[model samples]
Target chain A: MQKVGILGGGQLGRMLIQAGIDFDLDISVLDPDPNAPCKLFANRFEVGKLTDFDTVYQFGQTVDVLTIEIESVNVDALEKLHQEGKKVFPQPQVIRTIQDKRLQKQFYQTHQIPSPEFVLIDNKGQLADHADFLPAFQKLGKDGYDGRGVQKLTSPNDFEHGFDKPSLLEKLVDIDKEISVIVARNESGGMRTFPVVELVFHPAHNLVDYLLAPAQITPEQAAQAEALAQEVMLKLDMVGLLAIELFLTKEGKILVNEVAPRPHNSGHHTIKANGTSQYEQLWRAILNLPLGDTSAQSLAAMVNVLGASGHTGNAHYEGVNDTLGVKGAYLHLYGKKLTKPSRKMGHVTILDQTLQGLEEKIDLIKRSIKVVSK
Target chain B: MQKVGILGGGQLGRMLIQAGIDFDLDISVLDPDPNAPCKLFANRFEVGKLTDFDTVYQFGQTVDVLTIEIESVNVDALEKLHQEGKKVFPQPQVIRTIQDKRLQKQFYQTHQIPSPEFVLIDNKGQLADHADFLPAFQKLGKDGYDGRGVQKLTSPNDFEHGFDKPSLLEKLVDIDKEISVIVARNESGGMRTFPVVELVFHPAHNLVDYLLAPAQITPEQAAQAEALAQEVMLKLDMVGLLAIELFLTKEGKILVNEVAPRPHNSGHHTIKANGTSQYEQLWRAILNLPLGDTSAQSLAAMVNVLGASGHTGNAHYEGVNDTLGVKGAYLHLYGKKLTKPSRKMGHVTILDQTLQGLEEKIDLIKRSIKVVSK
Candidate 1:
């Protein structure tokens, strides 16, 4: 049996385990938490830190091919494994460029990829020198996700209190909508990309509230974004799935925001809306199998079920039953033992034959569902 | 957490384990073999005979709800468990009637359902008394599947040499084509049926070789079959997926042939073709959740991949790569350790926007692929 080892055991890893069944491939997952969601479905489960070289090296020994669910894995260990003749998808180089925001922006600049202008700051002292670049968007070099480690600076005083150590200050372009394109590639250079999806975030929390596929953009803009995503994949020389976050400016220009090197949150809607899910596509691409269809059968919107504020005891889903009663509403509760405010507990994807219909159903789901703690 | 215990640890159980991830429910499976296909994915796996009352009853004690992959499970133990407050879907009484051909036929007659004429015979002596019923079809009432334990008797002398006790004799059906309807129902009598699918079996093997959805039948005939299936569900009070096999006679009459009380193989195409898969629907129905949409997104055909005769060593597929190259062909391989002649190892479902195109693709898939053992 061909065994595929995954580096992290988050929800993406959990979903990948389900996709592995389609090909009957054996799966082994490594994560620090024993109760990680992917552990139960994988063929073998190992509790180990993702960034520890020894742990990753040991996990690599048991599988025919290796992949990652989270980008914050030990890249040096993955490079070693790749050199030792083990197939590592989303190659080590791709992870190296994406793990750090500073290097990621530099890579885009080096590749002539169109992205927002940014200035790299080595420390707080360097920020003083780039003070003229105020009103900048400050992002930590590494370990950032879901709007964390990112801030908008409107004055020079904001730079003085910016993040410690290495960071990047990018020009915050006036955006109309935040979008993402999930693309898959094989070792043989075969590639395919799903339609761009516009992300709508919660007004107060700034966390993604819903994902709208076939982003409300003109055909020309969609085509340009798809082509740009393909170019990014070729430049990265990446395999497996790559999710490219993009910004649509008011001037009708598309700029690269960032990229994730695994099965992404934005593509979750594909599980119910498309012919082949993003999880399934990741497995097929990594295994070098022919990719399945990527066409969506309907308009789909996904709503993340974030934990409500001031409730952090045992999880209790209020109004979940009522939300389930809505036609085409699919609720997926991540089996987490605890709930914290701003933490994603689960999500629901609603699909309909028309965009207006999907939007109406999503509005109902948004109003009727609550993820809280008892 | 509501725990569910499954009786058979095969592919059906494995698929259920995958679906259980979405609901965050715990699943345990019991099977006679230690290396059952479902062992790798289920939350807990126990080795025990499915037909052993003690084993089944003991397994049922660990879960709140109980179900089965195959109907051959011990009904007496399930009945005892149900009496003790365990929720057994497709109730034990339903399984008892469906497990044996004679009992199943009797139940149909008792309910005034339309079926072919048949007679139950305890031994060859009983058959001799009905000698005038020559050229009859004889089938062993128990342990019959995939054309096994069934034969056509040309004369009274034919039953003298090769005779089995407790068999049923019926008029040989002159079939134009075989078809099946899959229906799902909850305990509250809420039910829905998928579009009818026509089955094309291998001539000599008599195993379902291909399944074409939205069977090429008149609208009246499809309506008749669907209505009959719902009536059976209401009569049986089945609370899960029910697959009713039917024979379309040369005269265009539909006759009920048999029933499977779980996610049937005939509905596998729904995984890719329909809005909701039979696996997901079964989970929802048994859990008392509202049934999902069973409408097809496109036309589809499912072809079973059986191991070739005289080639049974280690299982290795020869034409898998070629088959994968076909557009819209979705392959599902059951993780089985061994392969023998006529062993069902996997299946491929082809989907298309049009029925005519799907039919053409089915012919291409049949001609291009061969399921051979290493």
Candidate 2:
């Protein structure tokens, strides 16, 4: 049996465990919390810190291959395991590039990948040196996800309350629609990319509010985006799934924003809309098995079900019955215990034979369901 | 949250766990073996005899709704649970009628459903009394599955090894191609049926060897078969996934063979070939959630991976890599620790845009893969 060890035990880890059953692969997961949603399904569950070198190393030793759910894992431990001949997908190098905004921006510049202009800020002293770059977007180089660890720097006064650690500043460009491209590659370099999807962020939370599959872009734009995403995969020498978040400017230019090494939240719609789900494709690519068909069976829209603000006790979903009554609306709750504002608890994917029909169903779902705390 | 408890933890139970995730429904499972494949995935797992009334009753109390993976479950306990107001799909009464060959045949006759002529035989002494019906097929239905507990009685000499218990004696069916229809219905009487699928049985095991979706038949014949299956569901008042197996004679007549009231193995192809998998449809029907799209997205062929004869030990799959090397061939292993001859371990489903292409791929999967005991 080929054993796979996952670093975190959140919903992504839980879904990966579900997908592992299809391949009959043994899975082991490490999480600090014993009641993590994924613990029940994985073949073996271990409680440990994701960033602890010894814990990550011990976990990696038990599996033939290692992967991760959250990106804040101990990279040095993974690098050590890879050096000892363990298969670490996405490669530690790729994760290193993505884990830090400075390294990621440097990679894009070195490879001539289309991206926004940015400058690395080592400290508050460095911010003054680049004072000309004021009114830029300042993002912490590490430990940032889902719109956290980021701020808009309008002047030197902003540096007084800025992050104590190093950060990167990027020129803010006016965006048309936030888009993402998910691609999978095998060890043999065979690549497959799903249709590009446009993301609409929640006005206040800045989290994905909704996703539109096969983003309504011109043929030329779609072709260019796809080519660029595939090229990035090849350049990174990545195996398994890679999700590239991009910014499409009003001027019709595409710029790379960031990339996730594993199955990203952006590709969750593929579970219901495409021939082969992103989880299944990730398994196939990691195992070097032949990939299945990647055609879209229908147009799909995905809406994130985050915890309603100010309700933070035990979790309770109101209007669940009404939501289920909607035609073609599929709900997935992450089996979470507590609910907090802006916390991801679950998601709903609405699929239809046509895009317009899906949009209508999505609108109904948006109005019908509320993920609250009781 | 509404919890569902399933009896029998096999591949069907495993697939139910996957669907349960999408529905955000909690599921518990009961199986005699502690290491049943679904034990690790279900929210709760209890090891007890499926036919033990007390064990089944205790398992039933753990969930709001109850269903079964196989029909051999203890009907008396389920009846008691039903009296207590717990929902048991394919009601205890329906299971009782379907469990016994004699009762099942009588119900069919009473409903005027098309079936072969048959008589009840208690022992060898009774067989001679019905001497005119000599050369009959004797089937002990109560505990029969996958061609077990069935025999072809040619003459009085064939009765030498008579049944130890009462059995159903039916006229031999001159089958052309065996087919099955999976019908799903909710408590509200809303129902849907999948396209008829042709079944090719293995020459020795008599188990389904291959299944071709959208059986090659005239549209009129397809509609007739679908209507007949629907009638059976309504007559039984079945409120779950019901799989009706049938025989198509050279005369193009459809004869009802039997029915399975839970997620049947024959519908596994729907996982990849249809808009909604049989697993998801079964969950929706039982929960009274709106049924999903059941239309076939593509033509598909499913080949069962049965353990090879003359080998019984630790399980090991041969030619898995070879089979997986083919495009569009999906292998599903049940995570069984041991393999015995004729035991169903897994299956491979090959899907394509056309039936011809699927057939070609099916042929390759059959030749390349061997499921054998180590």
Best by lDDT: 1
User: How do the residues B126-245 of candidate 1 rate in per-residue lDDT, one tens digit apiece?
Assistant: 887777776788888888877788888888778676456798888777888899999999766678899999997778897766898878899999999999999888889889999999
Docking quality band of candidate 2, CAPRI definitions: medium
Q: Which ten residues in a row have the lowest lDDT in candidate 2 chain A?
A: A319-328
Candidate 1 wrongly placed segments (more than 4 Å): A201-207, B201-208
**DockQ, each predicted model:** 0.65, 0.58
Query: Which one is best on TM-score?
Result: 1
lDDT of 1 by residue, A1-374 (tens): 68889999988888898878868788999999987877667789999999999999989988999999999999999999999999999899889999999999999999999899999878877877776776788999998877888998888777667888788999879888899999999877788888888998778998666898768788888899999999999999899999999999988889999999999999999988887889988988998877777887788899988888999977777776677778788888777667889677788989887878987888888888787887
**Steric collisions counted per model:** 0, 0
Q: How many angstroms is residue A267 displaced in model 2 relative to the true structure, after the best TM-score fit? A: 0.7
Task: Compare the candidates by DockQ and give the number of the best one.
Answer: 1
